[model samples]
Target: MEGNDLQRDGVARVLLWGAVLLAVAAGMRYGLLENGLLPRDCLAPGSPVAPCAFKTALVQSFLHQRLGWVSLVLGGLAFATAGRRLAWAGWLSGLSGLILYSYEPAAVGAMLALLVLARPRGEQRH
Candidate 1:
């Protein structure tokens, strides 16, 4: 029973983290990237505007699909090693990438992470 409870708690935490990351990614996409003044202000070279550099970096990351690749890698690691921490990392990155315009690999990574996460704790190798 205690083990079951621990598993439930771990699952809940993973879900909560995914939700929070999704929310943040959504906010970044819709709030700052799409319909916000940041992009416009960032057009000027060396704008020195607050958040301009940060937004640009994020945009670059999105364009390059860095998050999606990282998530996929982490998911593969988790799947190969059955490591709980790696699974959590994959899940979080997958959720973020899904929201940040990296859906293809993100979906596969998220599926792998979920599979690892769903395993019983006792059955997990790590």
Candidate 2:
């Protein structure tokens, strides 16, 4: 039972850290784009950034600019706590990150972290 708990905790740690790394990467990309180091319309088909383009500049800008920070905090909280409510919150945060930036790795890591945290202990299995 102790070993199982330890393993679960280890898994949780990995998930949390992975989420943080992904968040950081996403944030870095945002920073680059904002600074003009990278083209903002790279995701768009043509230049001049048409307002109706897929995932319009406005929406993409909002999501890309903010989701990373939100995910970072939520993922860190999920890592530090084991409460069920917090786990759910982490799931929500991850989903938002996924939607806003389509950052699968960060979102998936956060969701998995929540799952691990929310799982019943081995003692409860019986």
RMSD of each: 2.8, 8.5
Q: Candidate 1 residues 13-99, lDDT tens each?
A: 777778888899999888877877575666778876668878877877768788888889999999998887899989988998999
Model 1 steric clash pairs: none
| lDDT (Cα, 0-100) at 13 in candidate 2 | 59
Which ten-residue region of model 1 has the weakest summed lDDT? Answer: 1-10
Q: Give candidate 2's whole-model lDDT.
A: 0.53
Q: Can you tell me which runs of candidate 1 are displaced by over 4 Å?
A: 1-9, 41-46, 124-126
List the lowest-lDDT window of 10 residues for candidate 2. 49-58
Per-residue lDDT, model 2, residue 37, is: 46
